[model samples]
Target chain A: MGEFELIRRFFDRGDRAADGVVKGIGDDCAVLAPTPGWQWLVSTDMLVEGRHFLSTVDPERLGHKALAVNLSDLAACGARPRAFFLALALPRADAKFLEGFARGLFALADAHGIALAGGDTTAGPLNVCITVMGEAPQGQVLLRSGARAGDELWVSGTLGDARLALEVFRGTHSLPGDQFVQVRRAMELPQPRLALGQALRGIASSAIDVSDGLGGDLGHVLKASGVGAEVYFNALPRSAILAGQDLMLQQQCLLAGGDDYELVFTAAPEHHEAVKDAGARTGTRVTRVGRIRTEPGLDVLDSDGAPMAVLLASFDHFKS
Target chain B: MGEFELIRRFFDRGDRAADGVVKGIGDDCAVLAPTPGWQWLVSTDMLVEGRHFLSTVDPERLGHKALAVNLSDLAACGARPRAFFLALALPRADAKFLEGFARGLFALADAHGIALAGGDTTAGPLNVCITVMGEAPQGQVLLRSGARAGDELWVSGTLGDARLALEVFRGTHSLPGDQFVQVRRAMELPQPRLALGQALRGIASSAIDVSDGLGGDLGHVLKASGVGAEVYFNALPRSAILAGQDLMLQQQCLLAGGDDYELVFTAAPEHHEAVKDAGARTGTRVTRVGRIRTEPGLDVLDSDGAPMAVLLASFDHFKS
Candidate 1:
């Protein structure tokens, strides 16, 4: 099939009319009408086969993960998902592959009310690059630079499960069949905490998505905000499987393991209750794992409050 | 180097701030403030190594072509370039390649006054995907569906040079060193008709970019506008090199050669003088090559006004 035909059959969602879109697909450009009182938030992510995903991954989950990762960026900014542009490169227009991919992608997109505004398709090695556009009310958008010293550091949902799943895939660790399926799902199909992110807009002082491990991703917020952090290492929430692992393994996965698409945020101590309420309302589990500091370095504290000298490096695409 | 360091050294443009950009790089998502009286126009394009370009292409020229092709889509919509997000996947972090690529990319970006608001970079096969956001005054954006019967078809700049250059590279044709360089430049460094496109905003009834050959691209406008066209085949503007080629080669290049990056538009015959003024004001050479028709098929006519039997197919990414 031709490029246009491939797009029409798989990616086009013209039947589902979306609000704020002046013009959608089949045009040179997708035109959108921005809400009057909101600011546009844009983020992009590129996924390559055998680099970002395993060659054995199901096309459906791959599609979901591709868009989910971009949405995670929007979620970090406490922005509501609006629209996205997809640029896809495929070895060929395999009908079954496209069908499964679209099914997974649109399922998540429809859940978030994000429309497929426009895209380009071509023949090449498989690659999916998505640019997601979202919007946040003026002055309410969460930014990493907004954190202040003494703010309480918090995280949504559990951490390190995705990393545990990756370890299993690499044969560094093994799990029972049932548990393997569960953690593998965490690695393959991450949920972008949109509702929780939006809920934390006014409450959270700063926020970031935990895609590159808690320690490394939190370092970004510290650098941008010009503050340090004191993370209670033992306070980090993890799955039962990870908790059963050895202390060192648990520490490594909890601190430096990546691909956990959860929000790492900060809020003032006085608004602790408000933060908890926001999380409760959004149906997301909130855990206070650290606190911002005026000092210029991170300090991970053990359960007994002693500083731990953990040296697990975060996942770096090139260095890894 | 790590991904963050790579971005900081090469792609980050935090120094040169552009209007409407609330946040540029070093963030989860770039925030943009949309103009109140304008609408957002977004387009995306992906160029993969060995598919859209040769393996031996200059990094600088490839970068320029990457952004230029995306901007061409914005130009087709008569939108003013504003901000762009780039997602690049490279085989490795080659500093020299990045420096040259950034030089060409930033030069064009500076010329168009478009800002590099955000992007993602990863280690993988070479792929450059850019999503450009532009803006057009309310109700003034040109669209392919706006063409009507009796509207005069027009085009900006020359056609077929890029295709001729491709033919020479493919060993199907040959040119002198000096002339080859000229056509090669056309193929590699296409200039987007931004000025002419914006100038034709109110005057042109419909517009489209000639990326996938004149015949194929025009077919899109015809399909969208529910109108056909009678193209004056002899009147198609061409470079001296292309004009020197045989009639059959000329027909193939002019009709089905892609990657021209010129604007093909239609204006009411009553606004013919206004259209000419738009081109002159923008310093773009405009050619009156055809007229829109109520008939539902494109008809290419010879100098004697007789229909020609041209059967060249447009460039398709998959089929080609």
Candidate 2:
């Protein structure tokens, strides 16, 4: 089939009324009629083979992670996803690959009620680039620069499992087959905390997605808000698989290893109850692991309340 | 420099107030406040190293064309450029390359008043994907499904020069030094018909950008509008460089050779004067090339009005 025909058969969802998308695929440009008082939130993420994902990953799971990562950006901004565009470059028109990719893509899109608005498909090496558009009330959009001193730092869902899966995949560490199931799933099919993020709109003074580990991602909020933070190492939330590992490995994955799609946010101490309520309503586990401070550096405090410094760097594509 | 630091130092424009952009760059998601009553237009295009462009291309021109092609889609829909997101997967962080790329990117961005929003930068094979957003008045956006049976087909600017340059690059044909210069420019730095497209908004019945050849692109308008076309070979406007070529070569280049970022639209006979006036106001060269028909297929007519048959075909990445 032709590329255009391939697009219609695989990517076009046909109905977009549920999401307020006036036009979808097959047009020169997609038209969106956004909520009048809401501001538009837009973010783009590109995933490359070998760099972002292993070549052995299932096409279905790869598709899910590609869109899910972009959705996480919207979640960090406390925006409701309205639609997305997928620009894919594939080596060839492999039917099995296309079918699996499409299934995984629409599954997540359906859950969020996000329409596939428009995109381009071409022949090249495997690459997936997604641009997601969302909406939030004009003045109520959560921002990274909203944090202040004395605010409680919080993270939703578990951390470190995705990194554990990566280390195992890279042969740097080994986990029992049964123990790796959940970790592998964490690395492959992460769920964007859309509900909890939206609920934290008024509660979160600052927010960011933990894609590059909690400490590094939270660093963005601190730098933008002109504040510092104190992360209690013992307070970090980790899965059974991660917690069972050695403390050193746990610290490495929790603080610096990337691919965590959880949300890390800050709220005033007075809003602690509301933050927990938001997480509860969404059925997402939320934990208070740190505190925003007026000081200028990030301090990782030991369980005994003493500063313990070690190398924990964020994933920087250029530098690393 | 790290990816984040490189982004701040090079890509971030610092001031986005002029475009009504509430937030940009450093944020997880960029916030946009579009014109209140207008509908938003969005289009995405991906360029791979050896597919859409050659590796030997100048970084500056490649940067401009990457964004320009997407702008061309917005132009086809008669939308005014507002902003765009860049998702780049670079092979490495080369300071010289980044400097030239950013300079070219910002140059076109500044001219069109389009702000750079949030994007992802990663290390991988050379690939550039751009998603551009624009705005058009409600009920006035040009669509491919609006053409009537009896309408004049019009194209803005000249055609076939880009294809000639490609042929030269492939060693299939050669041009004089001066001729090659202009043809190479056409292939490298195409000027999106922003002003002309907006001018034709009310005058044209249907429109599309000629990226995949005029015949193929107009076929989209035909299929969408349920009409046919009669392209007059003698009537197609050509650049001075193209006109000096052999007749058979000229026919092939003008019909099926792609990469021409020109606008093609159809208008009723009664609106001819208005179309001319619009072109004059925008300082764009426009020509009438054919007429829409009630028949079932595109008919290419020879110089003397006889049915012309040739091996002209549109560029399909998969089939090619």
Candidate 3:
């Protein structure tokens, strides 16, 4: 069987046509109806083997993470994911690998009621590129340029566990077996803050997903919004496992290490209760880490209100 | 500079927001308003380094072709091009390659009036993945399953030259420099039949873009429609460069060799005049090379109306 037939049997959600997808797989294009007065939210992410992931990583988690990262982008926009198209390049079409990948992909897709749309499959170096389409009411879409000076900066869920797991996998650090499992889960299966994002549509002025670390991603929001930020490193959220690590390691992972998919957003201080309520409704922990400033550059602060400096940096694909 | 910064400086269309986009780059997601009451047509195509193209190919053409292929998918669905997101992974961020690639990509985007939405840049083996979004009025979207048993199978533009060009490139055959140029353009820089596809929406019953050769793609229509087709080899359209080739080479390229990117469609025989008008309106040549049959299998007929057999097969990534 060729790539098309294989996809038809395993990956294609043909039944989606009955569930709002005007057209699903097998067509040259998948078609869906947009909610009237809603804006389509688009995000594309490419994950390459050996660079974004390891060969040792199981295919199931790989598939989940591939779609989740793109979904995180939608979450940051306060958009509800409606569908996604996956362009996958496999070194070979091993049946075992395909089964695990599709299961993990459909599992996340089913939970979100997102349809698998259309894409191409090819044989080459292993890579997964997914383009997610979501929607938000017109004028309600969150944007990075919406942040203003004096806004409180808040982040959803814990940070640094994904990066901490990476260090452990790289042999730069070691953790007990149970701790390893916790961190690995954080790295492998990120639950994007979709509910929290939707609830913060009007409450949050600007938002970004923490993919390239809290410090770097927040820098983007500040840069785009023509403002700066002062993030109190001590106020940063970390999982119990990460909190138990060395102080410097915890600081490094929380501030500079990447692959966190939590939402970092800005809200007026007056909306603090609203932010907390949204987090509570979403069942996610929210932390107030800092405030947006009128200054031109970012500043990291310690608990003593003193400037803090660190050598670690957010992941830069080209620079790295 | 980081990947995001490089992308912003070179590829981001910040001004597109003033046109129709609610939000553009530097944001977590791009927000676009789809025309109300239209179905969103989504398609994605991935081009790998070694599997899809050669390292020696020009980067400019590579970029154009990458987007063109995805656009072709939209065309097959009779969708009008709107915007596309590009997720490009590069082995290294070479300045010259990026410039040429961007120039070619933007030129095509400008010609089609399609916006570059949002995508992530990453470091990895060279690969290009593009997701194109288009729109078609609900219920007017043409589908493969719409083909009827008595429909006349039609194809837009000339074919087979692309496959002929591939053989020349592979050093398996040789052609005059002028003939080589004609065929090479067919292979490297195919013009997707977008206008024709849109025009054929109401006239054509079903359509598919010929990426994997006429036989295989036609098979998709047959399978989806639960019908069969009998293609007349002598009636297949070919460019002068391809027509002058040996009989076997002509057969192989015309029947099995891929990457044509032309649209193959089915229209009722009674709508011949309407199909012709669509072709005329779109400035594309339409050829009737086959007829859909109620039989269970595809057939190839020689000039004498006798069964013809050959050893050519459509491009299949894993098998190839």
Name the runs in model 2 displaced over 4 angstroms: none
B240: Cα error in model 1, Å: 1.2
TM-score for each prediction? 0.99, 0.98, 0.97
Off by over 4 Å in 1: none
How many Å off is the CA of A299 in candidate 3? 2.3
All models, DockQ values?
Answer: 0.90, 0.85, 0.83
- For residues B1-320, what per-residue lDDT tens digits would candidate 2 score against the true structure? 88987888889877557477899888889999968889999999999988888899999998899998999999999999988999999888888888888888888888888888778899988899999999999889999999898999999999998899999999999988988999999999998999988998889999999998887888899999999999898889898889999988888789887889999899999999999998999999899999999996888899898889865579887778
Error of 3 at A251 (Å): 1.6
DockQ-derived CAPRI band for the predicted complex in model 2:
high
Candidate number achieving the greatest lDDT relative to the actual structure: 1
Interface RMSD of each: 0.8, 0.9, 1.1
Q: Say which docking band candidate 3 falls in.
A: high
lDDT of 3 by residue, B186-299 (tens): 888989888988998788999999999888888888989999989899899999878888999998898897899999999999999999999999899999998999996788
Q: TM-score of predicted model 1?
A: 0.99
- Put down candidate 1 lDDT per residue, A131-237, tens digits, no spaces: 99999999999999989999999999999888888889999989999999998999999999999999988899999999888889999999999999999987898
Backbone clashes in candidate 2 total 0
